[model samples]
Target: MGDGIVVGLGPVEVEAYIDFACPFCRQFELMAGPTLDRLLEDQLITFVRHPMDFLDAVSTTGYSTRAAAAAAAASDAGMFHEYARTLFANQPPEGGPGLTDGQLVQLGQEIGITGEQFPETVRRGTYLPWPPFVTQRAIGRGIGGTPSVFVDGVAIPARPGPILTAVQAAIDGAV
Candidate 1:
């Protein structure tokens, strides 16, 4: 894979740094999903979604880390984008209990990742330590917030229009 969960075959590389419990990231997902999906389908850019865990402490059960770990599990099962989009659509409020492991497994199952390993991996939080490394990687690159977007190594606004515009600009050699 290119970096995180690589999702397209395009010349430009786009990195989406997100936290499961971050409402802004959820909003970004809601707004940008269609546009990003179009871009990915058109092979305009390679989308690598880097799920992080900065908001784990906000939830009663460390939902951020759990969710990120589950996302890693989904990625391994070839369901990262679908499962993550579903999670975003059903996202629980920040500072709340968030989704339980069972709920996460249910969501994964809804997306067709129903293998026993998926649920077991989610419950075990096997990928718990991965988010910290992803966070540190983002931090090393000066990205400290959720919904941070990068196009070909350049930081771009997280909004849908700006993200698409930046992708186009990168493609046109304008940015």
Candidate 2:
């Protein structure tokens, strides 16, 4: 699987940015899930999923990256979202328990990516390198930690309420 980030929102276009593997990213997944779902249903925000694994070095992302690659391979098999859900659901605890490559193939199979090719994909580390400038941009935006959200290159502050408000504002501004 190749590495390409999907960036876009709304029925037409809104704002999109590179995302890394941070706990905050998962939090955003939870926090924004509802609004994002509504947007998807209404075709108000057409989210573009970009696969970026900034946490590659971080132990937390090791499993995610492998699983993401597996999902990517599964995408080639026409089951991207299914593999994604399975991977996220089974993400191992950072700095603690984790899934091995064998486990990843298992997940792929569970998500309907069943094949001998699945494990090979996971082993090859097929995903592309993380995007450049994302960390620098985040840091330049005063982000020292992860899960930083931005719109049109403007940093969205890191707070559930503030972040949500900022995201909404960004979407509104774009519209």
lDDT tens string, model 2, 1-175? 2223332345333232323245555666666556555555665544444444456566644554555566566666766645655665665655543577777778778766766676676677664233333334444546555554554445555344654465566557752
Candidate 2 RMSD to the real structure: 4.7
lDDT of 1 by residue, 55-146 (tens): 97778888888888899899889889998899899999889989989999999998899669999898887888888888888788788789
> Over the full model, what C-alpha lDDT does candidate 1 score relative to the true structure?
0.88
Provide the lowest-lDDT 10-residue window in model 2.
11-20
Whole-model lDDT values for every prediction: 0.88, 0.53
lDDT of 2: 0.53
Name the candidate that leads on TM-score.
1
TM-score of candidate 1 relative to the true fold: 0.94
